[model samples]
Target chain A: MSSATTFLLTTIMISFIINIAISLYGVFAKPSLVKKFIALTIFSDSVNSFAILIGFRRTPLGYPSIAVMPSPPQSVEDLKRFVSEAVDPVPQALVLTAVVIGLAVNMFLVGLIMLYYKYYGSTSTRRVKI
Target chain B: MSTLQDPLTGIAPLYLIAVAFLTAALGLVIRSNKFFKVFAIVNTAIVFAISAYIMHKVVDEGIQLYFFGGYPAPLGIAYEIDNLNALLGLLATSIMLLSGIYSAWYMNFPRTYLYYTLFLTLLAGSLGCLYTGDYFNFFVMLEVLSLSSYSLVAYFRDSPKSIEAAIRFAFTGIISSSFYLLSAFVAYASFGTLTMADIALKARDLNAVTQFSGGVVGNVAIASAMMIALASWTWTFKAAIFPNYFWLPDAVPEAPTPISAVFVGVIDLIGVYGAIRMFYTFFGQGSIALQFRSYTLEIFQILGAISVFIGVFLLLLQEDVKKFIAYSTISHLGLIFMALSLDSGEGISAAILHTISNSFAESLLFYSAGIAIVAVGRSINTLGVLRKYRVALAGIIIAMLNLIGVPPLLGFWSKYLIFKAFLDTGKIYGVVILVLATGISAIGYFKMLFSTLKPVEKIREDPRLRNSMLADITIALCVVILIAIGALYMLSPSARKFINEIGYNVIEGYKAYYAFLSSGS
Candidate 1:
């Protein structure tokens, strides 16, 4: 709603898009398995950040907001007002799970790469054929 | 009706998942192959029993909803079971049971405990995916299934090819799942809820409000389409549909045979189920769906047509038996997709029947192929070596016929229903494509049979074929079921009624689902 908030959101959006583009290029273009894994990690992190961005909210006072459990309010009216100011928490929670799953996948990829290197003496996918 | 007091609602679905995880932990602690084998079989059998009971309860008492930790549907995770999920749950558990039995004698890896643990975990994750009613929970379960499958594919760590296949599968699978997560995020942002029923309700409300106010609902429509597109990409990838099927043939053939059975038979079906559930239950009646339904169906039809032709052509070229079976699976999955894309009750029923029958046939094919491969040595890819093994060859022929949709087999009835669905819709192009694909697929199967059954001058008896009673029994059981189901269909009216009931339950069950959720029951 405000210029500062709009600018911040725009910057985050642009950075996230650029991160995804570069990571996707790396994943598809890189011949080495390790590079692809790194690219995938970056890609997943960008997705998580993008998800968090969707949950962002701006208050009437032109400040960024987050959803938190409000401590006791003075009245029901006060509680209603506070609730309207809070950002969505669902996407943030989803991002948390995504990050953990991403870590598990990345760790598994790293182990697979290690095994690949040990077996074929190279980490390049081009060199490994079934 | 009082919701929280109903003990049977929540506990039935959780039993399988809990038992699986408990057995997995026990496998880790004990590290004994015999102990884990027995544990896995017992747990899968129990899950199968529970699944059958849950199916009966669901059909008798209506849909069962399970909220976690006493929390309600919108706020906490829930598992919803209608006839559709109950049927799928039953199928998955039964396949896991058979696969477990087959693995007991088939799997000879040094790390048997780890294998059983991962196997059981995979089954649990699949069952969880089938049972869960929440979007985020479904994604988590999918990840569980994918991770376990990747590990299982690379189970033969000593073989470079298996590990290579696993690497490719894991990367592609992870990318697909990331897309799914992104779609879930979009859906949540649009609807502010992850529960499928709640989302459907809010989506309808949003559509109504936007239409009344003459506001810009284009953004909402675009978001819904984007979500569907993203999720469909993941599903098509997992189901080995057109343009995303490169990993399957490589991944499936390299896994151990029992794991291959699970991959081709059970895991891929879950992918199809996800697509159907998302499209039919969550988005079926929404405004966006109403706008995009025909377009989506067209896209699926085209893709399905491509997958069928390409799969059969590739199947005709494969020298390896496992790869051939994998290609056949892709072809059959394409047919299932086409049937589902018809978006009719008849279409859905046809797809479901095809799914069940195909699982049995494909798994039996894989098992028989594994036995034959063992008898001839793994390197002997040609079918000439199969001449000595008469029983395995017979099993393979029958299974292949089931796959080719020979009359009186279970496959024929399902295919006939799919064709009838096409005909009812007046989609002559779909009917033509289905007929052509079936013909080409039959040719491929005939080629395989001829190669295996042709007379050879000398037959060398392999010692490995001498003591293959486990595989023989497994194949025989599958064959018996395949023929028995076909015979029942031809003889009994109740069999047809049962299938139609499930069809109605899935196609017409969404309204009841939404109403129940809205009432907070």
Candidate 2:
């Protein structure tokens, strides 16, 4: 309901849109293999960031955005009390795994790219026609 | 005493794992040409022993959880061996051993230790991914598998297309891994657990924050988990799903037949295994349902149909014998998925049977292709590669026929089961599409065979190239074994029951086992 919560949510959604646009551009327009690879990597990272953002929550007090479970403390005052939970951890773990997988994939791509360059002396996607 | 109590409990399997590690180490240390032979044989044997032991543990004791240094599941890394993993582990080892022996004679160049080292490492990486319970450990193993495969795909660095294909394959692999990790993060955050069992159990209770109409809808917790669950489909690209299948046919052709055999034949099995484990065990009844909601099964069904159609269509067009077989592999996987998407007892059983048979038939295709190429001293495209070598061509033709689901062959029985499954479910459209795909694929297989029987041009055959009578016989022998298995499935209900039980264990999860246990009780 608060202004800051609204602002954070909007920011996350906009970034996700931008990520999709950039990835589409790279996949469709890029003439070079390396560029497409870079674009895909960026797109995946952006998506990962969006996943983390979705899990964010904000409290009435000055605390980090997080999720809150129901069932308040015993007293009425305790029930009204708010505390920030950390943002959802699931997306973050998924992102961590995705990033490492991305890196390994990048290393493999780089090796292939170098091999391609050695064989054809060009990184352009159109040049290496099978 | 704690770690080494029962014979089946821990000690033997651990020793076997050590032996597997030692084989990898030995492959690294030993540089002699002759040493590669020894290394390949010993390494494969050791891996087989380890897998067999693990498989025994899984069947007898349910999932086998091995915590290192006496640490338990929550605190330390766990190697979980359920039926799904146990099957894949056994599959990886057996195929690696079979194909490794077959490759010794098939590879044109001298047996360098590099080949064995890369081969064994690839085997280990795949097995590790199947067994490890922790998400992080699975990622690490996947990385090792991807790295090795990338190099193997580009091993014939002489061709630019090979490099290009590898690049594409690697990029796709990275994207898949990224999605996988993103999903993993989501699951971890949602449940605060990394252990597969715990995560599966905990993810179900996740309720979403109630929001306004325009805001985030549904349970936020479930949404996050679903996003994570769906991310894994990225790896389906690596698995050569319909649209993402471009690289497999091209990349697979560029590798040496043995490596190609491993890549197209065995590696995809690992992908299927990962998908099953993640979906069925970790996310099946838990977070996945919330995450996927209704679209998951529908999407899988659609993808399955497309892959089956596209793969068979492509297979029909393929002129290159190896490429034809590669396309067939994709088409077969599509059929497997179709059966899997059905999500029935019989349907799942059909998929598992198809997976096993296809692995063998595809490997046989690669092996025969290699032998014929060497014999004729050119690729399969050159005329008379098969006709000039009658015995060799016959062997490959039989394999190709087997591939096309001809009666009494391995492919026939599995394809039949899938048809029966669709019919049982009254999926008329699926049945029609499957029959059509099989009909079209038969043409592709025949073409490959046709090329083999054509007369040879007057190209000079190398005198020093020893005619591998043994290799030809081995190819024939594998075909026989495949046919025998297929025939066994036809005649015996017990074999069907055995396979069905394994499938039920895999696709239905603990529910199947619980039912069986209760009946016994």
Candidate 3:
């Protein structure tokens, strides 16, 4: 609702949009197999960014709380009481799981790509299906 | 206090999942010795018992929810159970236990041990997905299921085709997970919670942030929701529902026969379950006024319909038994999706029932096809003979009949229900599409059957082919279990009520779900 919170939200959304476009471009245009993997990484990063953005919060002093332990409030007048409510921990947990799974998928593919190179001596998927 | 939770029969879904998880962990460490098979079988047996316990609870006590660490509703993670999931959990465990037994007879020791571990892991992930109450946990559990499937697909890493299939599967898995996570994030941000009950509670109060007159949050909300839908679209592909289905038959065949059976039979069933859970539990029923109506529901319906048509059409073109069955899966899944999009109680119930029946039929088809291959010592097209291989051919015939939805088989009831649901809803066009699809499926199945049945003029007995006693027994058991269900369906109203009671409220909440989603509108 405030100007600063809106600004931070816009920044996160823009980054996410850019990452999505990059992944789309890779999916549609990239010829090399490894490039597609790189593109997938970029795509995953954007999703992770989206998760982080959901947890972004601002302090009562009108600045974004970069990171802090959400503490017990001393008084009702404490700005920290109003503004410093901890960001949703669920997204953080979700993103962590996604990153680990992403790593496993990447490892599997890298192994496959190496095998593909040995068999065909190329990384392009164009001729492989036929 | 622990006794109050009812330990033995009123077993939690998590305990069964933990049994699977711990079994997989144990197998990984001790896989070098012959003891691996014994341990794996024992582990699966334990999981089977746990699933049976959950099933008994559902049949007797109704849906059960367990919060980890004893946190109450709306605050802690909950494993909610009803008949739909209890049945699926039981079905998965039974199939896994049977397949584990069958694998010992049919599979080599080394591959058997490796696959058993991965198989249990995949089963755990699927069971977790079925029972979890939180939206984010659904996505996480889905990833656990998908990731294991990717590994299982690539288990035959020595083969290029298998590797390629695994890669594509992983790519699609990533896409689906992203879409699912994105959807969860948007729903959470908008509603300030991830629990389904809370989301439903909160959905009624919030309005879409409107800078102007229309209820749009500018570019922010649109992108978030689109990302979520895109993830689900990837699932549509993974489930082999028409256009995105090039991977199922090709990659699946390259895996060993038992693994292929689980992939098509159980794993794909889990994918369909994920879609239903997302649509009904997360998004509520189909409401056009909800944001992204055209993209989520309409586009999904069109995709589902196209998959039904194309799947059957493609099946009509395939002569190979496995490939034909693969296409049959796409067509059947299309019908399921059609029901899902319709979002009626009957439609959802029919889809759930159809899911189990299709899984049973697919397992029979794949296992039978494997046996046929072994007995003939060649592919179906290359093999010439029906009378020469009567038992294997009979297995194929029974499987084909079920796949084609011949009356009194497992497939027939589900098809009847799906068509009836469409007819009841006055979706005459949907019924027509289903009828036409079934017709084409019948032709496709018959073509494969006819190829297998072609008589050989001079039959040469091959000793190697005759040694497939284990494969024959496995197929016979699958057929018998399927037959047992047909009579059971005829004999019980309480049995029918068990399934309805579990999935009914999830479907009934559609109106409230839509209200929550459109409150801002």
Candidate 4:
């Protein structure tokens, strides 16, 4: 609710939306397959960032912490404090898996575009469209 | 652990996944075509038997949940076995088993080692998608299925058209699947758990199970709207309805014939299956999906109707037989979509039966066409060659009649149920949609089917076509299957009761479905 925090949050939110928009347009409109591939990477990365953001939560002390426990909780009070202070770990794990999948798909597509290039001598959809 | 999840029998789904890896490894180690053919066929038959055995267990014992890695529902992945998915599992394995035998001659082995590798992986991915209880897990399994299918669609790497279709298919597929991933994230963000049953429970009533989530979340209705909207885009694309229908015409013609059968028969049905699960089971009545969009289900009907119209008109113009079959797929899927959105148990069962029957008829047509195409070349104009092959001729006639929904066939009963379900729901326009769809589409069906009676301009022979005992047997098997299921419907009271029961469970079996989900924890 503080002025500085509000300013920071608004800026981050606006930029995230802008990034997603730019990446989407790139994927949809690019004439070159490789360019579209780049856009796809950014698009997936933006979604991954959103997934990571889903886990973000502020502690009672008004600071964000990673999903890891600060240390092994030795007491009930310690466990409760750790739970309240840390962000949710599940989305982070989900994002990790998504990242790996994105990499595999990207590599396969790049290889595919290369194959298409060999067959048609270009990666431009304009020239080699079905 | 639940007793139902206690046996080696519980690993029926896992066996397919492991076998897929085994097949992939075997391809690298062995170079013998005959060995791979027998091995693949034998493996598929065994899985088919296991699915049938476990399907009976599910029906008699109630819903079964098998936990992977022993980590209970919320923490680890789980597979939920129910009558609906059990039927799909049976469908998936049986179709793949039959396709294997058909492919024994269709695929040139040693050279097609990679094809079978991808084939088994596609099967595992489908089994995974059907059985997994986690929403995120569904996303992973869908990706597995899509990746293998993208490769298979471009199996003829020498052709630029095939590669281009594969590229477009891959790009569209990745983007659409990511949307599903986003839905899963939204669900996890809102429901505070990734387990599908937990999410369903939360969607219906958040306070019903307050144990897992003390986390912050969004409004259920708004969240459900976002999730359903995003997720259905993927389903529509997968089902090849409307705007997504663009890929099918291009992709189906380019792939080898058996892969074409896999596309129409096994792969497309999974899309309808996903939609049914998301709409009816995951977010059913009294959930935010109902309240958030006044016409969420109506959207299905409207899209279905347009897709049917578009598919039919296009089918009339397609010169390529494979592309014609692809358009027919769009029309059939649209009809299923309309049924799924209807207001009664009749709607759900009607959709399920149609999905089953439609896949059979469509695949049989493709298989029969394969025999002719390999001999005379791939064109509906060349279908005259089928006259010499009685099995292919019989296959085409029966499948076309069944697809056209001519009475006394298996396809007709499902179409009739869909009509009845529409009336039961008091949607008169549904009747208009059904009648006009069948009436108009039948012309295209006959135009193509009747081509077999016309004489060919010239004939070319492939020796394999003369020796296609395996394909002849496969076509006969398909023909027998279409007739048997149709006969059983009219003669057996149990058959009527069973299909009706599966339909009822689809619409109203949530309590039993709920218990299995929660039991995993």
Best by DockQ: 1
TM-score of each: 0.93, 0.82, 0.86, 0.96
Which pairs of residues collide in candidate 4?
A: none
Candidate 3 chain B: 10-residue stretch with minimal lDDT? B209-218
What's the lDDT for residue A11 in model 2?
A: 80
Model 3 stretches with alpha carbons more than 4 Å out: A1-8, A66-88, B1-3, B6-34, B109-111, B204-228, B285-295, B375-378, B382-391, B455-469, B498-503, B509-521
Q: What is candidate 2's lDDT per residue for A16-128, written digit by digit as tens?
A: 77886888588547878778878887877786777677566565554464444456556655544433354545456556766666676667677777777777778787855
Q: On residues B237-298, what C-alpha lDDT tens digit does candidate 4 reach at each position? A: 98888867778887888888888888888888788888888887778866667764447788
Model 3 lDDT, full chain set: 0.68
> For candidate 1, lDDT tens digit of each residue in A12-128?
889988998899888878999989998999989888888887766667778865545456767887777776687766788888888888788888889999999998888987765
Candidate 1 chain B has its poorest 10 consecutive residues by lDDT at: B208-217
Write candidate 2's Cα lDDT for B428-483 as tens digits: 88889888887888877666666665766655565324666545665776677687
Which number leads on TM-score? 4
- Candidate 1: Cα lDDT at B286: 46
State residue B29's C-alpha deviation in candidate 1, in Å: 5.6
Interface RMSD of each: 1.7, 3.4, 2.2, 1.4
Candidate 1 lDDT over B148-168, as tens digits, reads 999999999999888899998
CA-based DockQ, model 2:
0.36
Residues B236-322 of candidate 3 have per-residue lDDT tens digits of: 865777666777877676666777777777777776776666556545644222565335756667888998888888877765666
By lDDT, the best candidate is 4
Evaluating just chain A, the predictions reach TM-scores of: 0.86, 0.74, 0.78, 0.84
| Deviating ranges (above 4 Å) for candidate 2 | A1-17, A20-24, A40-105, B1-31, B108-111, B203-221, B282-294, B377-383, B387-391, B458-464, B467-470, B473-477, B506-521
Query: Interface RMSD, candidate 2?
Result: 3.4
